[model samples]
Target chain A: MAFDGDQLSALAAVVHEGSFDAAAQRLHVTPSAVSQRIKALEQQVGRVLVLRTRPCRPTDDGEVLVRLAGQMELLGRDAMAQLVPAPGASRAAPSSRRLPVAVNDDSMSTWFPAAVADLPADVLLDLRREDQELSADLLRDGTVMAAVTADPRAVQGCRVRRLGAMRYLAVAAPDRRDRWFADGLGAEVFAAAPLLAFNREDGLQERFVASVVGRRTTTPHVHYVPSQSAFVGLVEAGLGWGMVPEVAAAPLISAGALVEIRAGRHLDVPLYWQHWALRTPTLDDLTERVVRAAAKALRPVRRHGPPSTAG
Target chain B: MAFDGDQLSALAAVVHEGSFDAAAQRLHVTPSAVSQRIKALEQQVGRVLVLRTRPCRPTDDGEVLVRLAGQMELLGRDAMAQLVPAPGASRAAPSSRRLPVAVNDDSMSTWFPAAVADLPADVLLDLRREDQELSADLLRDGTVMAAVTADPRAVQGCRVRRLGAMRYLAVAAPDRRDRWFADGLGAEVFAAAPLLAFNREDGLQERFVASVVGRRTTTPHVHYVPSQSAFVGLVEAGLGWGMVPEVAAAPLISAGALVEIRAGRHLDVPLYWQHWALRTPTLDDLTERVVRAAAKALRPVRRHGPPSTAG
Candidate 1:
């Protein structure tokens, strides 16, 4: 069944604001009016749209509508901006468009801000920092208009472009290397060394270990530090050996704070830019800027064969 | 049916590593051994425990076991530490413990690091940065053992203690204030002005608006910038007016880079320290350090009523 945009927007507001009263305030309507709009929409959809809890949560069905509302809002704003006259010619406020994008934490801490800085002033960015592997879910669910994802496959109704690869080197502080690897970079030593992980989801270090030793073995003693910057700090402080991004590792490697564990082993996580296929000027500009930045900051995608000699 | 600790751990490893092979590697066993352990556990439990996806996700039953495994591991580690001699007396890895804790982004950017600094060298912190309002979800899901949360209510089997209130003031760049509020803080002007939000989950600005206008209403224009530091920068750059934490805004206020939108108007979000009721030395030390830091950094919890003179 088709739903009215206004009603869907009201429903989205309720879910976002958490309470009918707050949603009413956000919508500048009376609480009763907000209630009426939601009730009407729920009736139209013939499903329970929201779970009226302390922080109102959308039901599975409600989520679909909320996602639709967000997508429509984004597309509508972009379309309006395109149709409207230039800011100089118009008497209205400057055309400020909100672009919700999901980004992985590593990129958020490193190259993502530069890409954001490259966007036009009128575009307002709403960045959701999530794991690269999970960022595609945001695009699929319409929570974000675009995402920098590790998933090379395009989400339904989305376009994907290769952004490039984030290369990581297994490194450790000199003290840690001396202490943990006194014996050599064998399977036993790699398995025993205190390894650092970004989080439970992070498998880069484990993958590195598997590559070193033909197959997965006993888990290494691990210290999980989820922050992008702090993960590097822990390695520098001799806390644990970890996979450091090539961009962040270079200066430290040269400065002697960290040394490569195996000398030649590395991991390259290829990243992609995924966005809705609806083609908006804002999305186009953002994709262009991101593609340009990734080209300079990340390893280029090899057309034929693997580029890294290390792995 | 009772499940053995080994089997439970195996299940947790599978869920944690996201694959049987990875879990087998982590458990330092053959993939077949990992499979057999899981198969035995499933037989004992009489339920399908895990959904074998690319990155394996736990079925509802699997999550219960995973949570149990995590809790048992934590308690077991703490018990071992208690039984064992202190670091100087023992050579066994110095009783290193990993404490996965959730903290708000604002806290992470500001006072949280100092609190982390106070943690003992042997206690490794696995910090997860989440919004204060949502951090409790981590505690609930057993993803973290503790959290600095806005919700004062205790999660199941968790203890809650008042940390203190984080005070936020509505502020804007001088030019923004002058241009947007030239006619004063009227509802129309407020509704039209660009506002900054941390993300979609942020309703603080909307709540503040309702408080100012004395009713619920339509949402004002918003620019969502998820980073705490970047949100402040956006406000400073005159991109939007937003509520800035007192700890962060004070220096900018003194520097005349930002002006309080409405004098004395502020929002105080009372934060609490929530942790598993299972008392452990590491958890105790962390709570103590966090509480001590919050006392110095946050506004004291008021005994009676709201303190802000504006609202």
Candidate 2:
């Protein structure tokens, strides 16, 4: 079935701007006009697409339409970029095309900002911070066009490219290391020494501990720190020991502010750039930038088997 | 009717750990034992408290019990601190008492970490990051024991203390200012200049623009960069003009990398510390630390009238 571009855009704007009035301002239309378009679209779909909350949210049915609208808007901008500009003249900035992408906090704090800083003035980014292991879910549900994910397997209808592996070292402040694990990574140390976690969803520490102990065990004393920079800061402050990214930990470790809890024992989490398998220029450009950034910031991934597969 | 402490702890642990098996490991009990305790608690309350999701979540009723459990645990630790420690002897660390609090990103990246870093080794922190304006919802819903909030008005059953005001300046890279507003702040600037936002929920830029134009108007071109440091970095990269905290912007401004779009017309977001009125020692200690940090980092709030109030 064919849908009107204006109606789809209106529906997308309402969900994006969070209210009918705000959507009107965004689309340069009246609130009544936005309301009429939404109502008409709902009538055509025979399902209520939006929940009239304080910040309007897309219902499950609405999510499908929102994804469709976002794709159309991206493609339309690409078309404009190609068709409107004359040879040797600068391309007109396609200012309003928002590209939604999901990335983990660690990368967000480290190398991701560089990729974003290099974007053309025309394309705006809508970034969502999610755990690396879980970011693929955003792509599956069409909430984002691209994601930085830990899982090599991609969501259906998406393409995945290996973005190398992020290496984490188990480290602690010098004083904390002396006080807690003076002897070594003994079994008793796991139960006694304080450990830091990014959040409940963070399993990096657990994986590191499991590698050492050969079993999944919970640390009785743990601090749940959510921010990327703060997690490293806490470890540097002698609060707890945690798995720190090698790139972030190297300078601190050399400076005597931090020491490796166990030398040469590390966790390398493989990362992938997963995005919708469409030939959109913006998405393609982003993928190239992400792959380049990953190459610079992360350790190269080692593959053992045949590589090419549908994501 | 009196609620069992063991049952309450079990319920809280299950919600925090996100699974019955994980909660069992935390409580040092069998999974069946954890299940029985939850079932008994539900039967006594005559309501379903926990939803059996992949990561178990609290129902509205469960949230009430979770808050109760958290408060009781804090009080229990406070009592133990007094009773268990003798004069001139080192106090035993209460290792597992997780203190959940809500803080905004700007504060979290700056002064807030100092407060957390100073926390006694025993007290663990579970921080929830929300916008200063919306953080009070976590307090109202009993999801957080305390919050750094924008609103002076306190949540129900909570006490409010005037922390201070966080001042924000309208800033852009020197080059960006030269290109976009060569003539200075004009009616056409708001429509033509690209603006930076923390996210969709971030209204600081809009507020700044409205203040300049003497009315609310949309910036047609905008980029939403969510990270605190990244937002400022983008402004320095000549991507767009944005409302940046004065503390963060000052260094860049002095270095001539960033310039004020409009000087002396800054927005001051008055912040407050709101927490449950109950006299728990850890909460009291945390409040003092928060107040001290705010005093050091933010400008003092100017009171108008009627200083004392409930949150």
Candidate 3:
């Protein structure tokens, strides 16, 4: 319950590393002390938190303790970020802070670098994108302060801002489209049409098909292309047709090398910027930059969601 | 570059709870000490992790560190789990292991209880769902040792196992369908029809419309129901005709309350099971249980991406 920061660190490391010997090596602590410190904490908690599993384990009760121990590390790091704001500066940033964010792969790989480049040189932005959908779990577990998501609903204690819509188009090589639909590929023809998918969830094909067929099945005629660029390439190679982000598609569409299957129709996935309701100038700045970027990048935006009655 | 567990925990707590005072309360450290601890860490990390603004934020670099800290915590918890094999255990398991798992909402809600019930009492499963589309992300992060992903391509360290297809039926109340589509609905019908969406990621309606029309642009007539059961209930109430998971609709269809829009053909969302190539028994056991559950609950045959070169 009450671990001196060092003791907790030692405990967590020892527990994580399995043997006190292993943890000691990682923590640069002695095996004897590691064992003794754990015993002491076990005594303090009045519970057996760690099991003697070869590597080691925390009991259900131990998990509670370990979770706490883990939390301890998080707090320590936030504290650390403040103490040493800049390497050379003798004075600190007055208040030390840590910004936790959850982002999606597309955003992380394509957009985040640019966004960070726009931030103050000193301001830190921690980006973690598991899935934009599950990003809220970070919030639930008290991990991140902000997230970029397609959902408008806000988590408890958070505010939501519509970022705009990320439109995706189902495109393919002009030659491929011509071949596939030369005689005007209709329903049965689509059943045999070559298709590229972003992994499996790349439902642009499904969404495109569902939009056309009133939501049939994720067409069986599908090839699973895993990466973003590859999915585009597959479409370009005349291997199949897949959904490409409008921003990414703009160049290709203009090149006349790829044809939008359904011209004038795009899947507008509305996105939202959500963050804790707490007023931090830092959060304000992040919110501003993200919204501005989203506005420029996405379209048909509206600041909408269920009534904000909770706030 | 080198943060002992203590520093990481402290930072995590501060950013997570929003204030140093709150973080102190959570970590049971004095506010002054919390302040000092963060000060020390920032010095060590040589960068500002948090914005020190309202709530508090971690810089992008800070977030990377914080994410590392979070993973450290998770690893620490697993370590603890290994130490304590089971209740009242005197020693640790022969090996320490944590099974990272990816799952979706339906499977989680429907079969999770059974799956958990079926698992060995000693092992724990960290199940994550990217709703459906983003489920594969769990594979990418290594956060999950395994996942129930829609995507077939395996991540760098995992193997793919096909489970089965989750079928969805386009169903609605007779009155609603009759009122709207006496001769079948048109493209514009879906745009104005009371479409049901689970979250922003739920693309059932869009897919449905795409089945008939070319693609769905944007639908103004919409209802955002977050809960699965509630979403189905609204559709049953004739709020709008939307695609319902076959599992949820089974009883309703049997009772003749809900009519299938396009009967016989089910929107089969073929599911996949992917796991890391770790030799841990826990991961194997979890995989077995989940795969078994998927086999029983879903329909259609299953297929895997690539073999388990995860080892």
Candidate 4:
């Protein structure tokens, strides 16, 4: 059975706007019209698509439809951009398209925006700053069209392309490094030294320590600095040692503001661009920009995923 | 009936850790012991306190106990700091205390960290970077012990103290200002010029526009840059105009990279410190530092809150 574009658009709007009245305003229709469309769509599917909550949410079955709607929206916009006369060629102004994307904090602060700066002026970026480990969840839930994620595993109904690895170094303020690791790096030093973390959920420090110690050793003292820039600032301020992205840490190391706690120990997190399987012009354009940015900012990855394969 | 300290700690741990097993690891107790403590507390209150989800969450009833638990924990920590000898004096290292606080991103990027820097070394800050307009919600729900918030009205069981105002200026890159506002400030220009917002939920741009236009006016184009530093960076890159905090804008303004759209037309967002009414030494010390930092960094407020009060 064919899904009516109007009904799918109404469903996307209701879920996106979070209310029937708001959806109606966006669609330039009455609230009753939006409600009728939702009801008719539900009847056609023979399933309850939305949970009529304060902020309307899609049910499990509704998510599948929302993903389809999002894909169609992108394809439609791509088609229009190709067919419509360029701006200033005609009086008809092309409608702006919003592209929702998920990005991690480090990339957002560093290279991601550079890539975004190159996108077409008409595309509105709705960037969600999520953890690299969890960004794929946004794609799975249909909250975002694409994501810069670490997992490298393809989410169901999505395609994954390997971006280069973001290399991290265990660095500390010169004074902090001298004071904490005076004797040399050991399990005791790793356990006692106060660590700077992005947040409690951030596991980079733990993984870094584990790589050196050969076991998971909980550092007794931790300072949670949640901002990417500030996290680096705190490390430079001699507050604690932390895993600084190599791209961000290089300048400080050169300036003698920071020093690696142990020489040559590092973590290289492989990043991947995961997007809907559909090949729309906008998505493909964005993916290209993201991949290009990663190529410049990140180290070349030896292998992409956990289940290793020959390069 | 008296509340058990152990049970309260268990509740806070489980809720904060998001799983009983994780809570058990933090508390150094068996999962069954944590479960039993929760059950006993529920029986004592004769109310269901926790929802048994994958990550256990507090029920509405649970929040009350959690807040009480948080307050009690602070008081206990303060007492120990007073009663115990200094760290070097005894073999027993005083157990570290975790103080959770909510701070807005702009403040967190600028002055908030300075206040936190001066805090006693023993206090581990778990800072939640939330919007100033909504930071108070964290206090209301027992998620944070204190917040640097826009709302001066106290949350239930909390006391409010004014922390001066963060002044904001509508600024654009030199080229951007010359290009976009060459026609001078008017309703049409305001509606058509691209604006930078923290996010879709951010209403600062709309509010700034309304102040100029005498009513709410939607700007046709908006760029959502979520990072505080990156938001300013985008404005400096001549991407769009935005309401920049004066502290950050001052440097850029002096550097000739940014220019104000209209001279002397600024927004002063008065900030306040809201914390649990129970004044522990740690909380008081933190509050004093916050007030001092604000006094130095923020503009003096003419009055605080929606319902104005005589200074």
TM-score-superior candidate, 1 or 4: 4
For model 2, what is the error of residue B308's alpha carbon versus the real structure, in angstroms, after optimal superposition? 20
Tell me the TM-score of chain B in each candidate: 0.89, 0.87, 0.70, 0.93
Give lDDT per model, in order: 0.77, 0.79, 0.61, 0.81
Lowest lDDT sum, 10 consecutive residues, model 4 chain A, at: A85-94
Estimate, for each residue in B1-311, the C-alpha lDDT of model 2 and write its tens digit.
78999999999899878899999999999999999999999999999999999789899889888778877877887777667542221222343456888888887776677777867666778887775236666775466889887767877778999888888898998877888887667556676787888887788888777778778776867787777767787778777789888888898899998999877778888888999888977888999989888999998766984421111
Model 4 agreement with the true structure over B121-156: per-residue lDDT tens digits: 566778888752377667766789999887777888
Model 4: what TM-score? 0.92
lDDT of 3 by residue, A1-311 (tens): 35766666666676656777888897777888888888877788788867887767666666545545555555565456556654321122323233557765455434443443334423433455544348666554445667887667787667888777777787888876776666553555466565665443455567667666554653444544333444455466565677787877888889887898768766777777877766555667778878776777777554566422110
**Which of 3 and 4 is the better model by TM-score?**
4
Return the top candidate by TM-score: 4
Docking class of 3: incorrect
Per-residue C-alpha lDDT of model 1 across residues B187-244, encoded as one tens digit per residue: 7777677778887778788778778888765554677777675577668877778988
Share of native interface contacts present in candidate 3: 0.00
Clashes of each: 12, 2, 84, 0
| Model 2 complex DockQ against the native | 0.32
